[model samples]
Target chain A: MVKHKIVLLFPATVVEQPFLYHLVKDYNLIINVLKANINPRKEGTLVLELAGDKENYDSGIHFLESRGVKTVPLEQQIVWNEERCTQCGACTVICPTSALEMIRPEMTVTFNGEKCIACGHCLKACPARAVEEHY
Target chain B: MKVNRTYDEINERIKKGEAVVMTAEEIIPFVEEKGLEQAAREVDVVTTGTFGPMCSSGAFLNLGHPMPRMRMSEIYLNGVNAYGGIAAVDAYLGATEIPKTDPANTNFPGEFNYGGGHVIEDLIAGKEVYLEAYSYGTDCYPRKKLGTYIKLEDMNEAFMFNSRNAYQNYNVAVNLSEKTLYTYMGILKPNLGNANYSTSGQLSPLFNDPLLRTTGIGTRIFLGGTEGYVSWYGTQHNPSVNRSETGAPRTPSGTLSVIGDMKQMDAAWIRGVSFLGYGVSLMVGIGIPIPILNEEILRSAAVKDEELFAPVVDYSQGYPYGRGGPLGEVSYAQLKSGTIVIHDKEVPTAPLSSYPKAKEIAEILKSWIKEGQFLLTEPVEQLPSADSGKKLSPMKIRSRGEEN
Candidate 1:
């Protein structure tokens, strides 16, 4: 099984469709939405994490593209500039995952890339603007 | 075992290259492993630090009298206004004072690119700043108006005098309402989506000197890369807050009002910052060295993040004081874990204070003590304890014809 984060853009016509339901039932995939902004009869954007077998994941993407829905894989990761970072724990508090933490005694920030979900919480919370999103 | 040492004795040892020094970060583990008795005897001075936004801070500059001296009534420094209420040629540049064009609360605060704090930073960097002053023109001081440039060195006595700073501990801020909130704690996502905690935790000045035992009036400190003194107890200093057995406040408690010479400070240590949608503030770098007078002092300095806890407040409500009640008391360890369980819901966490910068200040102070350039001054008076029953009540209006 593979886990993939992707953004789905739905046009006004497909806003009423059960595209997500079809992906789960047909491809046997597990879907967890990170963010969604959708309005009826308007353009909608969705950020979701999908977990399924490689073949099924491929089929789901193909299926989404065929329905006039734009499916874009999420490849953005947070980049922390050490030179600019004051090691304030601002990013650690908002991070959904335990990716940013203050090491004891020394009292410095340590970033674990593997645990980061790229939620972009740190990007907004960082006062120094040291954390950036890079594809 | 009890430890005994004096400031003079410590200095004497330092003069003979026999004194032991360590940063608060370095001494904690050593004290834990070696025992307080041994560690207290081995360590002469332990430097503690905190780097956080201190809004109640500003610099007073005595600009040398221009060609013709004038009692300036209005003054602007680098586009940001300064209070010229003092004597002629003297001005106080508040940290939060912004430019007139960028009136605070008139529009988005993020649009304000610079303020008085930036002017101070520029001055410390050896950069010249535009100065504009106006007066009614007195006989002795004839100049009505003047526009020129000035540097920090040109000012006769430029000193940073913060009214309130070094908060003992602070609250962990979060938003519980549907709408997002912009605050000094940074932007809080709607519905407790994320929690931002500020403070250096154990590395903070007051935490290390809990109860203000060794951090009261006349205590020498490292303020913005220079030597400074604790002038008095900070404003709104409510020592009557809840505290742990080790004397560490569970909430915000004792604070320090400090004064330091700006001429001895460096630009790298002091910074001006704005919280985007929030207002402006000054990022002050302060380090206070705690002397190991006894085992109690050693034990207090050994307090860690796990032992410290702060209330996670809901900022969606009107002022932090009226944020209802806290979700619960959360340790710094749990706060730094990125996910705190509040009301059975997981909330993300962040911090506004810079631990990295705090650590750097601690290290810098350590080096200064090791080099025998910095000597810790024993506080002349200990701060009043919480049991003092000092109440700060709001002023009430007097009724018409009320008896005295």
Candidate 2:
């Protein structure tokens, strides 16, 4: 089984649809919602951790897109600019998760996208401003 | 029986590819195993390095005279203002200088995306930088203003004359307040959630030559990327500080003014960095090679991170308001260990200085000397020591009646 962190955006028209229920019941996917927000326009946005087999995960993603829901990998929203990074490790201690860590001996910072909860601590912690979020 | 080495002696061995050279970090272990005397006799030179955000860094640029000579009274590089009071076409672009349009701290924490330091990095990287200058038409210089793009190579002269570079030691910043604090030392989490320090510890040049015995004015060094020289004692050079047995300062003390040609520098060594809410600064890579003149010099050069200490100051209160002294003191070894206990609380530690980059710089300088491409120089004058009578004083605010 593969575990993935993703975000789903539902347009106003389909905001009330039970897409997550269908994925768990029909596609055999496990849904762990990290955050759920509904805007004044009635659009629903969810940050979730989804776990399922390969075929089931693909089918689950397809189901979301089949409706008016847009799926995006959670890691894709956060960008760590390697070229601009000085590898000073100021963000290493600030990251709540082990997403940002110092690779010892070499002392360079390595980023693990899967582990990042995108709490945005590193964004302010980095002296080099190497970490950024699109949304 | 005395063991000693000279600049000429070490340089000869380096020229012959026979010099026994090691980095500051390497000398520490070698001294422990072989003893200071033996290491002194064997090691010809101990190279030291540091890479940190130096806000006192800047470049003096002489963007060649415009089409019809203009005595520039004001100038901007990449939208960031530079000091243009030097001469007709010369200006000093400081690292912390931001554009006039920058909202700064009005929004609490400014992004500080681009500034003077970025322009310097862009120029060094062979990138085109927008240049704008304004002046009143003069007799010898007719042009009023000029707008153009200039590269480092195209400039008449470009050099870095930093007023202060490598600090001998520095404070380990932490916040004791309930709110998070943003500072030049990086962000300090509330209630000392985390601590931030910015020295390379054992590998640092100033720490290696704690007393400033061999590393001083006129001494050759690696600045940015190419060879540079220590020009003078940096501003705020406080030598009247507590010292270790090896003569290393216990707190923030000595600093060096450095100069170098910007044309020969590597873009990788000279970078532009931002400190969240603080501002922009240049991350400079500097290395100083200390010739093993005697066992005493060797003994100081071999000082380790465990022996060097930095004061843990509360940035929110003690620092800005000068309310009181540091909360406590911690060794560089402890600072580098990822965590330190303060007031029985295990506070995670982070370093703004990169140890790997410092090691890389030391290795590069070692290679340059080993290949005979570089040679050691005896400093014409030494820096002030623990008894130099140099005192860093606070400025007195003046009133209208005060003398100009």
Candidate 3:
């Protein structure tokens, strides 16, 4: 059976390096990293893409929990207030895994649970601060 | 007052292929030359270069000192005000007019006819200007040769072809920086079209061309020696040659290439230099944390990564891995309290080495988030504490709730 793939996201800083190093070293997993562009004016975040078996994935989560890190699961209703939404579409556009989609005709939006890697771009992009993770 | 490493020492390390950590004082000279202090003071925000101006067509590129070497100190500053020194300023130049062209006038062979006088005025005025000095549709001469207007439509097709080729190349770089990655991606404007244009004058559909869109994942981090990472991206059009009878009309033969073939000659000439400076800035910024949350820790990690990674990657080569110019070195004391100053100067020409380290750093940062180790630093007032017993009153309430 093929193992599942898990992704971890964090800010780019030294504080998180030790934790990431340990996770990468112990798990023997392939790590994917993301960060903001060169300009300081542009806002960006870092993402870690991990590929491994269920045990390794669970172990990574447990390690984060042990260190008091909050782990929000990917793709849930994520309560959203349409009033506060600027429709910047950062959530839909930056969703590396493509869990979110924009409904053009009705001007509504939808999210697919299975597709969400849970990078939390919607949380950052919503200028109105309307969207929040429900879990 | 100079702090940590002297200028000579830093230069030596840079010459020796090592990334020199810069301090605030060390970077002051460059900032002063760039006239950044006045620009920063006058504008609330600023943007510069092709990407800076094009992305915010109506905004100004705030000038900043080179990225400081002190890792922790710079981060503290950024944390205090995310928009302080690096925000985009309002544009002094007004709206640009896209010149209309007349296909009927075969005398001027091109799709657009930008007034020569207007073009010169914009360039001299320091506007975020874009021009195709050489293109099939337009003509651009040095300011001195403005009076000499020769009709190229009949005389030399080669001259017209070369000129158009040059302009297309220029626009490719400009569009890459202004349109593709920065303006379109950063501002979330999808109306802007891709850079690709066929000989038949047809443009590729939006998001269809990878060259016109940002790579799906973060590939690098821009280190700072002055302010932060400064980069440009775009496709290049290489004109092809075919044997035709002497009288046959010239066929414009070129395809728009993405950040493909990192080793292509023009790629090195254009993207390499733009990205090298960007890489240097990334190192500087990472080495000294800019005031975002957990900056100190991030700086430390970035420094460690730089130390480990710089040696392994070859700066002499193009893209992916390369060492940048000398890292400007400075001391901790200067960085903590002193301001990293910049004066006005012409933008420095492209750096020697071509490495995609900036992209690499960005990639690493993107992955770090996945690890769940990243935490945003909350404002001090927002943190719970005994001394600050008062809670933030409900926003958007105005007064005691009185329904309309």
Candidate 4:
């Protein structure tokens, strides 16, 4: 059996005792509060660190879903449109995840698929609508 | 009294059963009702101003002390986010560039230089300009000329958004801080100097300035060119009552009203010497209009009785004094400089009584107005005459007759 440590972050509004009561009762996983200061507009994400069998790790995904928690497996790919892209560096600046970085000297941009969190921050920030998330 | 009196003599028509043909005095209610309905359709225009440096050039200046002899050309070349508008910037480039491969071992240079300049022009001219700046091992110089031009455009956009965004963001942030300071100073005193959390989990600040402490809230709007900045300091409250019997008031009504109040309280509560600044500055050609209020006191004093009705000549000199008060000239100068500092420290402390320049401008404008060169127009329209209701009916009748 795989031992996974899953951490969930809560927005200030959801910190009430009633919400915690239902959450603690439903999940067998341990919960850890994130201490970093967060902007009110930002949505909180859960971080799960798993160590052990792959099968048990996969089962944990279903457990999270049963409690109405949405889960998306992260992927690494550069989705670009040949027609709409204008090669502006706006996506590079607004990407909180740092998935996109503009290469200096040439002033062109490059994407690091591995570092991408698929947050869609780049998409919203992009004026050209050139970037898309590939599965 | 005199034979059979006309219906006009009976204090205008006042028919009881035939739906009274009300005279002007009697139709006051109907007229007022229509006026009220018309007033409802009128749009309320609220405007504020901001002043700040935005974009890479501005950002560089704001980061620290001002730089001397900074040429516009240098800023255009090196500044990031240089372009004025995003739409203009987007028309010039491609998503990626084709990497140049080496024959030996098939190891490509880490830098993806497609070789050429004016790539943006090429892209716009229906040519595909695929140029990437990154490489695996070595640094890529994917067309140095293309990057130089593109950088200029980016810098312009950066300046546009930075200036405008900063203005708005700073206003809200400062306002938030002011509200928190007041709550802690007033209702929860003894702990006046101590910091505390608001009902909402935000911190408050205890202000050191006595003037700021006494004033529940203070707001200053500064307009410099097209850029504007607003700074507000004080307790968080909706409709920020100027005067109240009690210092504390009940929670205000409306969605986000409480949130606004909370932001103010929290901002004040945090007490970490909060300061926020935001405003938009045009990059290239856009010019913002400046509004000057025409005060009756200033106008009346400036214009001589003899010149009031004359065909005013040379109104330019008189314009300044006619609009602004004693500080009119100085304020105008400040507006042109494109910078307004609202905080106590930021505003000049020099006594206006002793300031010669300010006095000089005021005197000049005052003289011009007195010479009958300047005229002041009414800021608001007068109420319609009592006979207006009668005129409206006739006009409607005429229109209907024409249609038939």
Candidate 5:
């Protein structure tokens, strides 16, 4: 089985569609949502970790694109500036997944992008403005 | 046992390589092992440090006198505005000022790419900043306007004159509502998702001092990097805050206003920061050396995070004015553990202040003292310990025939 972390952007018109349900029912894929900002009559975004057969996952992604949804990987999104960070550890607490942490003795803040859920909590919490979200 | 080493005596010992010095973090364990009386006699100096975002900080600069001298009524540095009301050649740049590109009324966190704090950082980094000024032409000095670039070294006098800093202790923040919060305390997650505190805890200057005994006016300190002096009691300094038996405040109290020359400061110790959807502020590095004058001072400096307690306030209730009340008191050790329990639910904790940097500053100060490069200064003036308890009166319109 292959696992992929991706974001599904739904245009305001497609906000009512149950795209996530179809992934589990029709595509036979496991969907663990990391974040969801779906509101009626508004553009919606869903970040999910999908796991299934490689062929099934590929087909599911193709089906999502065919339905006028935009897909982007999590890697292309966030920027963490280490030079400007004072290692205050403000971002580590609000991080839903253990993406950010403070190292011992020196009290430096370390970020592991692989574990990040992209909740954007650190963006505001940071007094140094070291964390930035491009998308 | 009476232990008293005057500033001159301490300086003499330092010169003779006989003075004993240690960081506040290091002296605690030594005092615990040797007892306060012994430690007080042996340890000459205890260095205290704190690295945090000090919003009430700024710098005053005296740029060179321009030809055909003009009174600068308007000034901008690196595209950020500076207050030119002081004098024709001097200006004050605030730390939290929003840049001209993003005026206050613009929108949420409007394009705060650079600000006054950034300009200060750039200046200290030895970068040239564009300066622009406008003034009404005067008969004695008829220059109408001027524009130029200025470097820190080129300015006649540049000093950080912070009106308030080194807070004795502060509140820990949390959000109880369904929505999140962004504050100087860092981000507070919804439904107690997280708690944010901004202090170095045991390593903070005020944390070590507890009471305002040794850290009064004229106290020499390591501000940024160069030597600085505590000028006065900071604004809103409430020494009357209720405290625990150990002397840690249950509320905000005892603050210091300090001044230091920018020529001696290093850019690495000063920085500009922008809070997302909030505003810009300065990240300052301050280190204070506390002399072990007696057993009382030694005991106070030995206080640890586990023994000190702070209130976890709910900021979602309306920030500073919120009446949601304190959830509970927790020690710095518990908060530093990365997780806290609020209302019987597990919540993670984050710190806005850099304890590692605070430790680093203390180490730096210790080295300076050990090498006899930094000397301790006895306070020239004692800080006021009593609160005036005076209330601010609101402006009222005069009634007909009233106060004729």
Candidate 6:
């Protein structure tokens, strides 16, 4: 099974639709919503991790795009600036998935993008501004 | 054999490229294999380092006067306020000073993205910083206001003078409350989910000389990747705290007031940091070479992490309400082990101080001494001892407006 972090942008038109429920039931996928921000009658943005077979994952993306919802890889939006990181490990506690983990013995902080769910916690939680989110 | 070497004797060997030096971490194993006497007789200097957020830090800038100088009464750099009370062209910018327009906590958990610390970092990187100054027109100088861009090289003189730094030891902050706590200690998860600590453990400079035997006024040090000196005993320096048998303070104690030329400092060593919910602070890299004059000094310099202990404080109640400790005391060894048992719960632990960077700084300082470029200096006067009757005083609050 493949798990991918994707962000879904819902226009005001589709804000009331049942999109996540359909993705799980139709594609046989496991969906974990990391964060969701919706402005009443304006727009909505969702960050989620979806796990399924490769074919089902592709079909899920096609299904999402067909519903007038914009899909973007979470990796394309968030950046962990290694140059600015002092490896202080302050962001490690704030990160839920241990994505920003400190390498022991060396005590240096490293980011594993695969484990990140884009909760947007480490973006401002980082003291160095090393974690940036473009979206 | 007894070893009683003086600073002059050590400097003589350093001048001729014959001084033996080791970092604080390296000295531990060396002293373990060879005894303290042997290590003391052989090693000339033991270097120590710490890279952490020191909030009581700032820079003094002598911004060259504009063509029509007006005895500037107000000044700012990069939207952050600088203390303009010093002189017409001189100002002191503190690390935590945020912009006046910053929406600080009006919206809870404020994001202080930029501040004076960023300004200092930019200045040292040879980047242009926007400067704005205003003045009430004076007879000698008529210009009412000035706006210009300035660089570090253009300044008359720039120096970093931190009031308190290199805290000998600090508490391990945790949260016992049901809700999370956003603190200067970093974020503390609810119900003691995690613990956060700073200070480079054994590699910390003050921890090496717990009693301040060698580190004192006028002692040379590596500050922000440049040579600097201990200006004084730092503010709130309380050496009379609880201690271990080896003379290391189990609680936070002696601090150093350091000064260095900002013109010579490297941008990599001085960085701007923002703590979520808390304001901004400056992360400074400092390294001090402890002259191993005798076996006693060598023994102290070889102090290991296991011997160092810090109190675990609950930031939600204990830290903010009272300065009471130690939900339980844990050694640095336990702290570095990734988790600590607090109230029967295995809470994960993390350090705000970078051990790798601290080691890097210690290695760099060791190399400088080994290369005959850096020499040791005797402290002009030693810091006050734990038995010196020194106490950290608190401000007297006058509810009736009774002036002190």
Candidate topping TM-score:
6
Quick one: RMSD of model 2?
A: 2.5
Clashes of each: 7, 0, 95, 52, 0, 0
Model 3 Cα RMSD, Å? 29.1
Better of 4 and 5 by DockQ: 5
Q: Determine which window of 10 residues in candidate 6 chain A has minimal summed lDDT.
A: A112-121
What TM-score does model 2 achieve against the real structure?
0.94
Could you say which candidate leads in DockQ?
6
TM-score of each: 0.80, 0.94, 0.22, 0.20, 0.84, 0.95
**Model 2 shows how many backbone clashes?**
0
Interface root-mean-square deviation (Å) of every model: 3.0, 1.5, 19.3, 21.7, 2.3, 0.9
Q: Tell me the alpha-carbon RMSD of every candidate.
A: 6.2, 2.5, 29.1, 28.3, 4.8, 2.2
Query: Judged by lDDT against the true structure, how good is candidate 5?
Result: 0.82
Model 3, stretches more than 4 Å misplaced? A1-17, A34-46, A67-70, A76-98, A113-129, A132-135, B1-404
Judging by TM-score, tell me the better candidate of 2 and 4.
2
lDDT of 5 by residue, B195-286 (tens): 88888888989878877778889999999878889999887787776777777776667788999999889887888877655577888899
Question: What is the fnat value (0 to 1) for candidate 3?
Answer: 0.00
Q: Which ten residues in a row have the lowest lDDT in candidate 4 chain B?
A: B200-209
lDDT of 4 at B348: 16
Residue B203 C-alpha lDDT in model 3? 9
TM-score, cand. 6 vs. native: 0.95
For candidate 2 chain B, the 10 contiguous residues with the lowest summed lDDT are B1-10
What DockQ does candidate 4 have relative to the true complex? 0.01
lDDT of 6 by residue, B1-404 (tens): 38999999999999998999999999999999998888888999999999999999999989987877767788889989999887888999999999888897788789898999989999999999999889998888789899988899999999999999999999999999999788899888899989999999999999999989999999999999999999999998999999999999998899999999999999999999998789999999999999988999989899999999999999988978885656989999898888999999999888998888899999999999989999888889988979898989777878887887
lDDT of 1 by residue, B1-404 (tens): 57888789988877676678887778878988998899888888888888888889999899889887888889999888899998998999999888887856666535345787778878888899999999999998899999999988888999999998988898888888898677888878798878888788878888888877788889989999899999999987888878888888898788889999999898878877666666667889999988888888888888888889898888877345563676789988787666788889998666678777888899998888888888778788887767787644545568989754
TM-score of chain A of 5: 0.87
> What 10-residue stretch in candidate 6 chain B is worst by lDDT?
B319-328
Q: Which portions of model 2 show Cα errors greater than 4 Å?
A: A9-29, A35-46, A52-56, A132-135, B398-404
Query: Residue B145 CA error for candidate 5 (Å)?
Result: 2.4
Worst window of 10 by summed lDDT in candidate 5 chain B: B386-395
Across residues B1-404, which tens digit of lDDT does each residue of candidate 3 receive?
11222223423433454422222222234334544443222211001010111111111122221222111111111011111132221112211222333232243212222222122222322233331111122123112111112211211110000011101111110111222232211212122211111110000011111121111112111221111211221122222322122111122122211111111111111110001011100001121111111222112222211111010111122112323421222111211111211122111111111112222223333333223222212122221111323222223545667763
Q: Write the per-residue lDDT of candidate 4 for residues B1-404, one digit (tens) a residue.
A: 11232222221211222112221111224434544233212211111111111121121111111122111211121111222222212221111212133121133211212211122223223333232221122123122222222322222221111111111111100111222222101111121111111110000001000011111111111111112121121122122212112221112100000001111111101111100111111111111111111121111112111111101111122222243211111121231121223332122111101112112222332232233332222212222212223121112335544872
